[model samples]
Each structure stands twice: as structure tokens, then as C-alpha cells.
Target: MYIKRSIFSDSFIRLLAVFLGGAIGSLARAAIVIPLAINPLISVFLCNITGSVLYIFAARICGKNLKLVKDFAATGFCGGLTTFSTVCKDGAVSIQDGEFLLSFAIFALNLLFCVASIHIIDSLADKFGKASK
Candidate 1:
């Protein structure tokens, strides 16, 4: 006997969810980054911070059973919105330009803010969750 696989298989659906979410997230990032006259590093930093906060919010809101939401929001959207490669490139470029302090500051601040935003959002979500119950 031969088995036929449906087009909307679980894995396929999950992949589609991620792909759609990523496309939207990437477009959103570009929309923000492309128009700003500010430093490229600053734009990327803002995106990273925003993405971190969004990921935490999604994780808390989605909970354990909402795998699609988690995958789309936290994994796909956040991953697309935040550009670690750009951050690394910025740091490298700064270093090459002999701006050692600037490179260090960019790396340090990004790390600090992203981690802090995650904790702050998670804490706020916990508090709100308790208050709502």
C-alpha cells in the first residue's frame, strides 16, 4: 500500500507560518531602517531592541500550546527583524575605521539592551498575568 501526503501537512504548515511571518517582519524592518537618516548602527540597535521586546511578549502571550504563534512571532518574526549579522558588520567596520571605542560601545549596548528588554517584558507579562487572574 502507498501513502499519500497532503500539501497542508503539519510540517509544511509550520514552515509556511514561519515564512509568511518572516516576510512581514523583514518588510517591517526595511520600512523602518530604509527611511531613517540616522546612523545604520542606531537603526539596527532599535530594531534589535524592538524585536527582543516583541519576542518576549509573544512568548508570554502564546504560552505552551500555541506552537504556531510561538514559531511565527518569536522565532520567525523576531529572527527576521533583528539583524545580528549587521551588528557584527557594523562593529567590524567601526574597528577597521580605528574606532575601537565605538565598536565596543555598539556591541556592549546591544547586548545590554536586548537582554534587559527581554527580562523587563517578561516581568511585566508575569505581573499582568497575575493581575488578570
Candidate 2:
């Protein structure tokens, strides 16, 4: 029998970093978002956008895997904090249980909403930055 290791865990240290980083990210998310029950769609929208920006910065800072900080920060923290797997699982279940159209619609809705939120946020921020300068 063979056991497959996590992508980050091809080696022991990498695995440890991923676990620790993910724990930190998950904990931070719980701390920040648990206080209020916001709309699920809004929460997902914001989180996905936030996670994407963080990922861009993290990979840049990581620089050829030499910086563990980026990997841990993005993969562990942002990845853990985001709800992508939940979306995938829900979508899959919806489709498998014979609601293929509904599942597809939900998936499309998520993608559309998330992308729109990102655009809105960036556009506003850019405007704000210009105004401040």
C-alpha cells in the first residue's frame, strides 16, 4: 500500500510548514469572520478576491521557492482561508444528485460574482489612490 503525501509535503519540512501556515491562516480567518454572520455570497466574494491578491504578492515574494514565507503565507494561509474546496464539493454534489443545471448555474454565479467584486474593489482602490496623490 502506498500513501500519497500533500503537494507541499513531498518533504517533511515543507509538510510541516504547510500545516503550520494553514493553521495560522484558518485561525486568523475564524478570528476575523466569526464575529458576524455576513451573507454567504458576499463573504465568499470578498474572501476569494482577497485570497487572489495575497497569492500574487506571496508568489512574488517567495521567489523560486527560496522564501518559505510566501508559500506558507499563500498556500497555507490564503488557501486555507478561502472556500474554494467547499465550492467545488457543493457544486459536485449538486451535479451528481441530478441537479446538473443548478450546479452549473451556481458555479457560474460564483465565478461571475467573484470576478466582479475583484474588479470593483480594484477600480475603487485605484481611484482612491489617485485622489489621495
Candidate 3:
């Protein structure tokens, strides 16, 4: 039997990657929101969409060998950049305010776009061998 060890297998390195990536992602989100001063709904929409696309591409590119890319980009960066809680909150508030249409729109948009982006990116990656196994 043979064992393989990668730098990313170290718990410390993984933790560091996640921490640094999360910090940067969060800062990036703040930078966009602050400078744009967009409405919460719009901001959340943009963030989730962008994060979804980025996550899909990064995950594919990272593949199996590049655990660092998976940790930093997909897990930490995308996790920090996209706010599911915020989207849920906004939806709930909209519903409470009798804005059912807006709430539905947000919910649908988030789901559909995220799912579609993942599928599209994955297909493209497979076709182009973004991260060949």
C-alpha cells in the first residue's frame, strides 16, 4: 500500500488558506457594497451571482490535487462572498412587508442562477479540461 501526502493535507495550511481567503473575500464584498451603495437586495443579488460563478470555476480548476484552491476559493472565498443568510433574511422581510413578488424573485434568482452557473461552468471545464484528472 502507498500513502500520499500533500501540503494541503496539513490542517494548519488548510486553516490558514481558508482564513486568508475568507478575509479577502469579505473585504472584497465590503468594497463593492460600500463604494456602490447599492440597495441590500441588489447587493446581495450581485454578490451571490458573482460568488456562484467564481466558486464553480475555482472548484473545477482546483480539482483534486489543488486542495488549496478548493479551500481558499470555493470554501472560504465563496462562503464569505455569498450570503445565503442575508438572502433568506431579505426574502423573509420582503414577505413580511407584503412584497411577495420581490421575495419570490430573489429566491428564484439565487437558486436558478447558482444552479445554472455551476452546471455551465462544470460543463465548460469538462470540455476544456480546466483541471484534468
The prediction achieving the highest TM-score against the true structure is 1
- Location of the lowest summed lDDT over 10 successive residues in candidate 3: 1-10
Give candidate 3 regions above 4 Å deviation: 1-9, 130-133
**Which is better, 2 or 3, measured by TM-score?**
3
TM-score for each prediction?
0.89, 0.58, 0.84
- Model 3 lDDT tens row, 1-133: 1233554367778899999889988998888777886786788778888999999888777889898879999899998898888889999999999999999999998999889988988897777775675
Segments of candidate 2 deviating more than 4 angstroms:
1-10, 89-106, 109-133
Candidate 1 C-alpha RMSD relative to the actual structure: 2.2
For each candidate, the alpha-carbon lDDT, in order, equals 0.89, 0.70, 0.86
Model 1, runs deviating above 4 Å: 1-8, 130-133
- Let me know the TM-score candidate 2 reaches against the reference structure: 0.58
Per-residue lDDT of candidate 1, residues 1-133 (tens digit): 1233564587788998899889888998998899999887889999999999998888888889899989999889998999889989999999999999999999999999999989988888788889999
- Enumerate clash totals for all models, in the order shown: 0, 0, 0
User: What are the per-residue Cα lDDT tens digits for candidate 2 across 63-98?
Assistant: 686666765887888887777776787678877999
lDDT of 1 at 66: 98
Q: Write down the worst ten-residue block by lDDT for model 2.
A: 1-10
Number of the predicted model whose lDDT against the real structure is largest: 1
lDDT of 3 at 87: 88
